[model samples]
Target: MTLREIMRYAGTLYSANVAASVVTFGVTVLISRDISRADLGIYGLFQAYFLFGAYASSFGLAPATVKWVASGAVDDGEFLTFMALRLAGISGLLYVAAGVAYLLSFKVLAVALFALPAYQVFSVGLSAARARLWRRREALVLVFASLVTSAWIFALLLAHHGYWAPILGQVLGAYSTAFVMIAYVMTRNLPRLRWPGAWRRAFWGTALPVFLGSAVFAIGELADRLVIRHVLGLADLGVYVMALTLFNVLNKPVHMLSRVLLSHFSQADHGVGHAGALEIVRINLVVLPLMGLAAAAVLPWIMPFLLNRDYAQAFPVFAVLTVVILVKAIELVQSSVAVAQNSATSNMRAQVVALAAYGMAVFFLTRAFGLIGVAWAVVLRWTVLTVVQRLDLKRRGVDILPSHLLVRASVAYLVALAFFPIAPWFMGIAYLALGAVFRLWRAPRAWRLAIGRAQN
Candidate 1:
């Protein structure tokens, strides 16, 4: 796809994603305030398993789906046959593993394990939708529908059931999306249940490294929550989970944007080549700082209002997480290099290293300082990731954007950091104004370019 088409698709994807994220955030705030600490602790424990499931379920099928579909390996019946066999075999084994765990009363582990392949199934369909391109609007619709329904479920559960409500909503939402994906596949007339025929080799060969890489990545993030539970106790785990939820909200906008952007990059001319990579970086620089400023300004009152008054203490955690986000954002810019080079292996390897760094940092830090040390560990990991990836990308001759832009963006971020001590309300207003004016300024040019691109 051309750059303009990519941007257009990204914008649409972001609109849908942002809507879902906002609702999820709102629900999270409510849960954090109302749910008991012990319940939240249970939730956090389960979530680690869920994350592991998410990583495992994909069995690396996501990138594989994206790769083959984009490469036109599945333009006919044979490709579909191969994919169906692979998914069936993988999903079957996964379900067996999940059933065993569930029957054993390993609820957290079971839920997470089952959810992994379930999530992967959903991701594969979503990736297929992107590959098809014409299916983009439909994919967004399914996602939005699932989000709205999930939110409704959560709200109802909160009034009647409390802790179980969020999990019910989460499971329903996940399955709802999965169902939509399956329907999309059937309707598209892709090949269904053909002979397995070399499917294992193709699927396993691609997924093993990616799976291992993702496992490490999962451990990096999940270890923090696990540590909090073990060292600091479940109450602390609950509190930290709430803090992480808020932190996730802070990160979601940019992350959603990044996902949409990456989908485009996956199919980019020359596969997100140097110039395309630079353009993506430029857009991120413009968008992410503004997002950070906006987050800093509004989160205090937002925390109290959305969650309960009890969560006001989470503000410091929110602040630390926001900075952690910026660190990761820098690393993402470098990751564009790995993506463009068609080296998922390299990306996976880098993630492994980052995971190890993060795990070690969290272990020591949490032992010494509790939550704050854990937070610091996150910051350390992000820093290490950025530096390590930059060095790796540079040595590989894949430095897409100029160093000066990086310097300027870093300086801008530092200035925004100065606004933290400002009253939340005032800071929010200022950032809101800044975002408004920036959007207004860009509108006329953006419109003209839109017209020009269309006419061309």
Candidate 2:
């Protein structure tokens, strides 16, 4: 696809993501406000386990599916069959694990384990849809599923169901999406399932490192929550989780852009080897830090009203986390480049080192400081990952941003941080104005080139 086409598709996907994110954010706010803080903390704990289970059951198969489907190396039916077989094997083990947890009276852990297969199925379906460039269909699926989940949870809350409402709503949503996607696939002229030896080998070969890396990263992501729960208690965990939820909502646009760029860069011509990577770096540098500043400026005032006055304490944690979001946005672009280049090992190594560092940092930092330390630990982890990924890309001859651009962006971020506490509204307005100036100066030429390419 031409650059214009990619941008158009990215815009579509971003719109869909934004809509879903907005609804999801609303649902989260409702849950936080309505549910007890201790229940919210339990929910957060369940989520951490759910994420771990989902990533573990995926075994990197989702990305493998995307890579192969985009490259036209695997037929849909064959890929589906492979995923089914893999899911069966993984689910069996997970079921046993869940049973053991249940026997031990670990209800939430068991529930999270039971939800794994459906989560993986829904995830893989989305991956497949993206690989096929079915952005509208993918968007519809996501929005519809989120709406269903939100509605169910709302109904349960109205009926006076407690924490189980969201948990069950999540499981129901996963199954609903999985059923719809599977039915859609069945409507296609897909061949009967068969065991294909070569494809199995190919899938596992590509997936193992991605799986290991994702699993490690997933564990690292949960470390802070676990520490808070153990050391600080459930109410604090609830506050931190709510803060992170807000961070995720604010960071959704960058996440969507990175998702689109992964597929776009995978297929685009890289004659000089760094065109896609450089474009991603430049775009993120312009967009992410500004978004982070805006969030930092606004979240402090809005969060209390959104959740409760009790959550007002989470503002400082949220502000520190905006830096984490900024750094993560850049790191995500680099990681997408690595994925697109079929150099998953590079990312795997970077994630391994970063996860180790994150684990150690969270342990000590949470001991020294409370929830704020967890936020800072996250920023430190992402910074290390970004630096390592940049070095890896540089060694591979990719032209990253110039040092001057990095310095300028860093200075702008520091200035925004300094201004946040004193005059947050002014900080937001000034950052937006600077972002506007940067876009006006930089984007026109890029748009012209994209249009030229599209016309050609």
Candidate 3:
């Protein structure tokens, strides 16, 4: 496929994922409104733990699967079966661990633990859909899963399950998606379960690098929860988690872009480096800030309207995290290209460095600045990460970002942040004016021309 075709596929799925994520985001709104701060904290911890658990156990299998199938290095059935058995064994250990938690009197989290297996199954299947470029199927499955999460949460909330409501809702939605994914596989005729033949080396090559590098990053992503709980207390964690909930809603598009880009980069050999990198960076610079600024514009109203006073304190943290968005948007391009080029260690190294910086940051910043400090520390983590990854890319002849454009995006963010605490309305206006001055939207046309040249 050409770069254009890859981008087109990414666009199609991005639109669909956005529509589905809107419905899913409503579940977050409902949960935040309905639960108390302590309950909210407990719920947030549940999500963070299970999500990390899933990512850790899956061991980058999702991206690895995308690389394998997209590159035509593995048969879909054998690989799928390989993943299922592998995860099944891990699930057994997880179940045992959850049982131990229950015995230790953490009943709520223990029951919620079942979501891990559900997520594993869903990811294994979704990886197949992405590999085959089954865009419509992927979109429909996403829609179905998201709707299930929404409907189940609504039902559970009305039934007064408290924190248990959202937890159970996620468990059910994941299992529901897992069921649908199973059907997708059955339609293709299940391959006889067998050991790896020629694909073993390819399998480990992608999986090990991805897992080793990403595991530390995953820990960093969840570390804030632990820090907040220990230093500030559970209610404070709940307050901070509220900000993350909003951020995740807007982050759906970024996630979609990475998934699609990995497939594209795996297939298209010509635009795998410098020029391809530039186009994606430009696209993210246009989209991420727009999402953050727009989301920021409504927060002064939405926080008060949707949440209680206690939970509404997430505003400052949410605001600071918006700055992180400016940096994070470009990561999809850097990461996808690195993995596609078989340089997952670059990501591994970057994540290690960032996580270390983030640890010290949380230690000092949380003490000095409180929750907002934790938030700024997160911004610091991503900034360090992006710089490290960009340097690695440069060494490989993939200069993913231009200095001027990077500065433009950073300047626009600083302007927005400067005015944000005073008046979010002004922040929006300032960002828009800066965006105009910077001509952020002009990248698309240039990106098209660039891709055209690179593809040729």
Q: What TM-score against the true fold does each predicted structure earn? A: 0.83, 0.91, 0.91
Q: Please name the candidate that would achieve the greatest lDDT relative to the true structure.
A: 3
Of models 2 and 3, which has the larger TM-score? 3
lDDT of 1 by residue, 31-125 (tens): 66667887788887777778866775666766556555665544446556666676788778878998999899986677666655556666666
* Pairs that collide, model 3: none
Question: Total clashes, candidate 3?
Answer: 0
Q: How does residue 119 of candidate 1 score in lDDT?
A: 66
Write down the lDDT of every candidate, Cα atoms only. 0.63, 0.74, 0.79
Model 3 bad stretches (over 4 Å):
1-4, 191-194, 270-273, 403-408, 432-444, 447-456
Candidate 3 lDDT over residue span 207-319, tens digit each: 88788777787798789988999999988988888889888877777777788888878887745445666766766776678778778778767667766455656877887
Name the best candidate (by TM-score). Answer: 3
Query: Which pairs, if any, clash in model 1?
Result: 53-116, 57-116, 57-117
